[model samples]
Target: MKVAVLGLDCATPQLVFDQFKSDLPNLSRLMAEGIYGELESTHPPITVPAWSCMMSSRDPGELGCYGFRNRKDHSYNGYSLANALAVQEPLVWDYLQEQGLRSILLGVPQTYPPRPILGEMVTCFLTPSTQSEYTYPAALKDEIERISGGYILDVENFRTDNKQAILDQIFEMTRRRFRVAKHLIAHHPWDFFMMVEMGVDRIHHGFWKYFDREHPKYEPGNPFENAMREYYQFVDQEIGEILSLLGQDCAVMVVSDHGAKKMVGGICINEWLMKQGYLRLKEAPSKPTPFSKVEIDWDHTLAWGEGGYYGRLFLNVKGREPRGQIEPGDYEKVRDRLIADIQAIEDPAGRGIGSIAMRPEELYRATRGIPPDLIVYFGNLDWRSVGSVGYGAVHTFDNDTGPDDANHAQHGIFILQVPGRTGGHNHDDLRVYDVAPTILDLFGVSISREMQGKIIR
Candidate 1:
């Protein structure tokens, strides 16, 4: 079967699977035609990295990225796809081409300067925020532009989700994305065709509350909330259209790196560090830290996870941390103390923070080469985390009453649908890494031995 994979980043199967099967006639038909299932993703399940795993069939560490930014010590900058493509690694397209199979790729995240366009590919997802720097073969540019209508134009006006005008922008963008998808599929015919929708991820961050009962800003059918769901349905309809376009002799695979949920509260590790004396700040330093300004004592602070999966942790180390003050031997003690405190602490209303603090070994078995010193699993409340060390307050109150019964914490749930069945989500399901291997498997391709993922089929 010719495989066409569509990645809906931040889409939780649980949230949409049953709903789509019951409400979306087209999707239900596809489920009946082929295999489908909920795919479990990697830990700290954020975007850039998970999608990278899908492309490379390797863990982010092996691929050399854990999130949008590496966040080593205090260093920060976004990861680019150029570095990834240079690894001499065997991507699915490359493997398929060696075997003489043609493929087309478009909008796959963490992809840049689209290379080895066996058929035709336009890298739109994870595009540069400011300008277009397409890497597809020159032969395909005209075709791409013709179909895409001169590349995706970012919406100009910015309005909060609560505003109707902004909601309109979202609706327009969603339509544009589907238009591009249909046009591309119509213009190409190959063994494998892949596309990813980043709009889902962005919309979640911008309008998570409407969907989550626990969000402080949630207002279901709130114009923004309504718009988000409507956009999702629109995507479903688009999927139906794409399947129809594919006809027979092709199998449709839909997956997401992770899903969206609310973040009701967060644990500021920096604050905890300050309280624990692991970090010290001068009333005024001659120079400010990276995140700190002259007016803001940024020496020590807490944040929700800043990178991969938004669930990472790091310590301000002696040589690594600019504001490091903790003793080397005490790193474990500090982590233990914070983990204990965070694991047991509750929100202002008396709710536990995380279920528990897990040692790196205890949680993510595949470190991907560099695991954090600690892994924390927050309870059903919204999450706030960071992957660095510092001092300041550890816990703070975030206000947002959720939907009377809307589910709050669901970033890591499993995607279970007919035709494909994997165990439901658990901390151990690292299926996101399996994405790359599965794509390759569909084409009977092989990967390097150093790669960490296995073939999903």
Candidate 2:
């Protein structure tokens, strides 16, 4: 059977299955004729690792990708962006290719530096620019540019205050992506096809506050209250067009890397560490500054953290890091202490924020590469982790990087429709890893012993 997977980045279950269900008729119809539910995302629920985890049936630790960026080694300069080269795990399409089946991959994350496959390939948003070779055959880039009239890798500067420009860019990008997808489906030879649309994620991060009443910055009678809803409808219409092109034997699945929720604020992790006496610096900045730009006194610091949607804390163990302070014997002692302290943290109102911290070894089947000492969800992901120092207070509403209004949730939405099967069923226990196995099963491919998820059936 042919398989088509539609990936919507950061697509929240609430909007897909509940809040905007009536507006998303294409998705609503899919729900009535297919199995649908929330798909549990990876530990940190960030884009880079979550999509990699879903396609490879591996956890972030096994993939060795903690977030968008990872530390290459113990050195301070070891930090690098996670790309196609960083991941070595075999994906579902890799297994399919071994069986002599052709597959089409479009905009799948971590696909930049596009590798050769049995069929066509278009890299993900990580592609530096059109100047770079973004397509596998090299000539496909010209075809795509001709058909789509110019393609956008991703929305640039999505976190800016100018809402109109951001909205326009998002729509234009989505239009081009869908246009390219339809063109590929009509002309390419394929047994499996997959495309991920990033506009869902970009719009949520850019316009969530205006639509979500639970947002801290929500206002009554805003001009953009219906902005998110309109985008969903537009995406649904695009889905309908694609659905009409698929054959009767095609098995379709829709998924997201993670869900999106209103961000209450940010917890300046470096500032909090300084307050708790775990991190020491040579000199403090008068204003907020990135942690990487500051001079750290590694001899005195016990631990440090890198922040994004979640927090990654690294311990300064002797012999592991240069001028490390904590001895080898004190590694667990220091990690456990920091975990306890980070979890016990309270919000600005003095109420417990329900923060959670865990060791990387505790979450994955096997740890690979340079894993973080601790993975944390500040306020259970209601608040983002801020890596900047000199924020004065532990809590701040302003994002260090830009004006992001939302943070990722632990559960993303999923929908599966198998050919020649009874329709309508809700599978509530689905996980991101389960996707790879299910697709393999549909195509009669053997599930590898190394794969960590069960088939949905």
Candidate 3:
């Protein structure tokens, strides 16, 4: 069976079905033709682990990756940015290759330093440069550049105030990526083909404030108010082109790693921990500093948090960390206390901010790597956690990276279309892990026992 998977990063089911359904004709037609649903993403719902989990059918713990940054060692501070090399589990493509099925993979995340596959592979978002050997066999890189002008890995420097420039770059990037994809589809022979469009996620992050009417800072008649809609429409056209290239026997599936929503603001997590006496700095720096840069009094510190789309808290256990403080016997006691306190944290208005706190072992199949003591979704995904300290206040108006306007939501989009099918099926219980098993089943391959997700069919 021929299968084509199109990944629209950060696409939301609510926005696609409920709000902008009229704007996306391609997606709408797919939903009517087959099955569609709200697919639940990984815990914290960040990009790195979410996409990896979908491809491997393994939870974060089983995959040994939590987010973009993972603990390099068991020390209190050491961390390395996660990439394709960090993923321990075998990818679905690896399984397909074992069956002698040739596949083409393009622009999937955590695929940098492209590995050898049965067919061609152009690495994903983390590719350092087009000048680098981003494609398998190396020579394919030159051919791709000659065909599409150049390989567009991703839109660079997305955190600028210039919205129009960012939009233009996303458009050009999308166009080039699709151009290359069409070329490969037409020329290259393969049983399976998959590519992810990252422009959707970039647009959401840069323009959500303008698109989301519910945002407090939104302006009604803003020039870029309809930017998101226009971009989706453009993406729909691209999807239509892709579908037209495929034969009637090919099955199609469209998905997203996670969804996006308006970010209210950022919570200064390190400062809040300091105020609660859970964290102690040797000397409060005049300027905001990252956790790694500051001199921490580990003996006095009980718990500390690293900030991102959500907060990752680590406990100073006596034996685990170098300057450990919390005893092994009291590990549960301290963890429970911290979880309770984090759940009870309030907003500036004195209203309780509803948050979900979880222990890694309880949520995933195994806690392989140095797992966080507590994983928190601040204000339940509305407010991001700021890792920088010495902000003085508990809240901020912008992201530490730059002027990002959106945060990750729990649900993403999933649509599967089989030819000659009638009466569309809608599944509300789909999870990201289910995709891998379902895809394997479609190609007549056995789903591994290690995979936690069940086949949708």
Q: What is the TM-score of each candidate against the true structure?
A: 0.78, 0.99, 0.98
Please state the error at residue 169 of candidate 2 in Å. Answer: 0.4
Ranking by TM-score: 2, 3, 1
User: What lDDT score is found at residue 137 in candidate 3?
Assistant: 69
Off by over 4 Å in 3: none
- Best prediction by TM-score: 2
Clash totals in order: 30, 0, 0
lDDT of 3 by residue, 45-87 (tens): 9889899899999999988888888888878768877788888
**Could you say which candidate leads in lDDT?**
2
Question: Which is better, 1 or 2, measured by TM-score?
Answer: 2
Per-residue C-alpha lDDT of model 2 across residues 112-198, encoded as one tens digit per residue:
899999999999999999889999899999998998899899999999999999999999999999999999999999999999999
Report the lDDT of model 1 for residue 114.
58
Runs off by more than 4 Å, candidate 1: 72-89, 153-162, 214-216, 219-221, 284-290, 294-311, 319-330, 355-372, 375-381, 386-430, 446-457
Q: What does candidate 1 score on TM?
A: 0.78
Global lDDT of each candidate: 0.56, 0.93, 0.89
lDDT per residue (tens digit) for residues 96-161 in model 1: 777878877777765665566577766655555424556467666666566556665344333242
Deviation in angstroms for 300 in model 1? Answer: 9.8
Clashes of 1: 30
Between candidates 1 and 2, name the one with more favorable lDDT.
2
